[model samples]
Target: MDTKLLQEIEKGTKSALIKKNIINYYIQSGSSTITELSKVLDLSIPTVTKLIAEMCDDGYIEDKGKLETSGGRHPSLYGLNPESGFFIGVDIKHFRVHIGIMNFKGDLIDEDLIPYSIENSPESLDHLCKIILSFIHKQNIKQDKILNININISGRVNPESGYSYSIFYFEERPLSEIISSKIGYRVTIDNDTRSMTYGEYLAGCVNNEKNIIFVNVSWGLAIGIIIDGKIYSGKSGFSGEFGHIQAFDNEILCHCGKKGCLETEASGAAIYRHLKQAIKDGASSILSKKILEGKHITLQDIIEATNKEDILCIELVERTGLELGKHIAGLINIFNPEMVIIGGTVSLTADYIMQPIKTAIRKYSLNLVNKDSKIVLSNLRDRGGMIGACLLARTRLFEI
Candidate 1:
């Protein structure tokens, strides 16, 4: 399982680039006959054969028995050796972290969730680094085989520079570089919403729809936009701040220090605040006793309450969904995406939120444009972020 061989590929060699293309093809299309590879990679038969043989000997690619055929001889198939490389994806949230492991073939082989806190302090970053290293050590694989790590943190992350401007933003050097140095591995940093969007696009319900939007309704609100089959990062990689668009007239100050932002009404933080105020105003619901006892309620508890048929919780969640959809209708009039995915911690409440979101979109957006967009829930649920991190790490590492 040595893809350190990849690190040695010379920058300018024709054969070196061809070999990378072959591997990339397998990653995207799975196993294929050399004949198919020759045609797809646009190399002569002899060249494809020679390189395929060399890759086999170098342990970069391996022989699968043959492609199934009806009558004639089955063509021999070649594909990447999944053991050659591994990737780790970590999705860090406010009080928990999810770690996932993926092999070279783009399969999520294993995953885990651990309770943790993310904060803007050197000590917090140090803890994040140590926990990642510890998690790696606990897995039953060679450390060198784990070629890269991708960390998905909530905030403004310039993936090109690996700098997070919000969570764990207490450093001059790139956070990816810091974690890489500590863990002794190549690392990439990504935005949590973007990572989750990638997860939903590749592993969720997205299928051939090039234009899509993923709205994350979590502790905060943001979006992941895919345009023409690629994630749209805008001009400065700071796109998808969907919740910050000015939409209200009230003086509800957002944590971003802005007033009348949609997040002040639609995010998990907003829900928590509103729910507490409702209870304080003597509204009785399933959580009334807990609220009276001063027990802290989490987004997860609200989701659970909705599932338990709590009337007040369901109403608040629907209100958030309606607010979110109202803003998304404006997006539809602009981008007219084929699909809009409702995800994040609050999304686990399922249709308790989605119905209102869809209702708002239909009510506000143009009928022609809104009908073109299909609203759905994330199939991967809360798992999208970590899985997306692994994908980002794997594919981006291949670019290098």
Candidate 2:
């Protein structure tokens, strides 16, 4: 190698080390006082001060005024600049796609959702690309000012390659590469359930605990596992495919071409199926009107029906919860996670579902694992997947 190039590499290496330390401090403190950052980073006050000043000059961070003083000068607070660069989060669901934009603080500055389907093989990606491109154009932000684009998708993913195994229409064309190349920014893609779990970890959930499981109860069931603050993508990039685990010996078929899978018996799709049959059998509820109208029954319809004290819907949800809890108890036994986070539209039935879930777990799980683990709802809702994408991109920027 040329000596000049070698010298530049050394200089870059040193700079990256300093930046990594500073970034770690910022992420740990959430937002830090300069003195605090300096102390945590173990640097002289002046050296740390100058480094922060330089980062501010480069538009990476900003002074956010002062902290409380205790008969002393108020120390200044510093935070990642909200306007420095924007990150876009796109969540592709079974029925729709939600797009969100945020600055470094992860606050939602803008968001919109539109109906989307994978039925059309060629047009799906085209439509998705158009939606994102149009969103950026309408915002009037320079393309170069966008730092990263993050996408969350429902289904199996090859985490190492950022490829979706189920979104085969985009096969041979990695979605991340396509988006990044077209939009002139870094792009990230991951399984939606896992993304949401990562978002909870970043938000300091589980008392900042490390091992966590985020279970998404949606049209299909899925789980995201985080070990030591990182996603545990197993061999062949397949881990936590809990939905396909056998939950029953019945004849119900699952989308993954399996019979008696957990999702076939316990997912939002399963709940919808039960409600449709009950309504067909003359069960009475406001949803019966929708059934009479020949309209599609959604997870929301079941949730509302249960909330209205519809006996059949309540029974169905309780049964589903019991099935889910059994699956969860198995996970608790195996992983012994510190926390299990439940998320998705089905959690709307959490009130009707939680007790039965706990009942099943208490009935099956080992006392020790069950004792230390707490099951909770995701704080970020559907937004967790998108936020996790941003964290995915942000971590890359600061990682070794």
Candidate 3:
């Protein structure tokens, strides 16, 4: 082919891909009219109408009745064929792995949870792979119909290269590539905090917010930054290590080999450690019974104790909340985000945790910045990372 002709063909192919992506976006966002899609996709109404008509004829989309309008005629709404394809999202945490399966229309089909410590076993990856395979088999979905697998892990991840800095013992090969080869599927990987941030952007508390911060305060603390309506994975995809920021001069060592890091003071692990130490020091509390009974007191136990207004649990949570809030206040001053969402299992405590955080924000952050930023609890909670993994797969599969 002539060079000019080849260039023309490439351009046409790119345009078609973009149009198809628009269709996928509409599908994921639920039913919408051509006018709405055109506006969202930045395409002309005539072009959107033509593409929608083609998709309808191809059985990829169908008229889903009409949407009520203010004054004009009801607009015809189009939605995707639910049976078109499937997606899987896997969230690999320190102590558990969560899997979620969804269809083309973004409806969650099924989910599974497997509890296993990644740090304790060398064969954790093999076990995880087996569980994933078993879960897929249980879904009764064909392998070919599954578009992609998205995995979110806690660490610095290069989404494009599929390598994680803090996982799989930093092995020679990229984790995503290895998993894809084993599972016989295309795979994408990302940092768990970033994934949860994107999840909130798509379907949680930070929806439609251009500038936002999502803080995950589980076993550890991490923050996800969103700038200009997109996840801001800084150079080397390691931007959101908020937990490692220096908070105190105490000799307490952090897991990252640092002393007095924010995570050492404010994370769920930190809270558990402090509570255990206090119990060892003969401090009286509800959790002391568990410790005396030779049972390890978990973060959940502390949260439940706080619910019952136990003095020790209440005080410890408040202290951790204050520490976390101080760090978040610093983030607010530096990033000037429109919103900050506190997520993870700890956030379930509601006012007990949030009250102290709010107070600390007021005391530490600049009045102008703190007053404008809305700090709220995440609606997605622990599921944000898994949902985000599915969204990541959908975005890549449809090029949306």
Task: Report the number of the highest-lDDT candidate.
Answer: 1
Candidate 2, residue 127: CA error in Å? 1.2
Model 1: per-residue lDDT, tens digit, 217-275?
89999999999878887765788998888889989998788899889999998888888
Off by over 4 Å in 3: 1-12, 27-29, 39-46, 53-60, 67-75, 120-122
Candidate 3 lDDT over 3-104, as tens digits, reads 231233346675557556765577447788888888888889988898777666655577899898798798898888666678899997656788999887
Model 2 score (lDDT): 0.76
Q: What TM-score do all the candidates reach, one by one?
A: 0.94, 0.87, 0.89
| Residue 200 displacement in candidate 3 (angstroms) | 1.8
For 1-400, candidate 2 gives per-residue lDDT tens digits of 1123123334677754786677656755668887788778788898888878877877777898888877778888998776776778787777778787876665667888777774536577778888788787877566666766778777777755878777744557777787677666677777777767777788635577888988888888999888886788787667778899876898987888889898988988998887888778888777888887898766766777788888888888899899999889999999998888888778777678888888999999999889999988777776776677666556545554
Model 1 lDDT at residue 17: 73
lDDT of 2 at 146: 72
**Clashes in model 2: which pairs?**
none
Go through the candidates in order and give the clash count of each.
Answer: 0, 0, 0
Better of 1 and 2 by TM-score: 1
Residue 100's lDDT within candidate 1 is: 90
Whose TM-score is higher: candidate 2's or candidate 3's?
A: 3
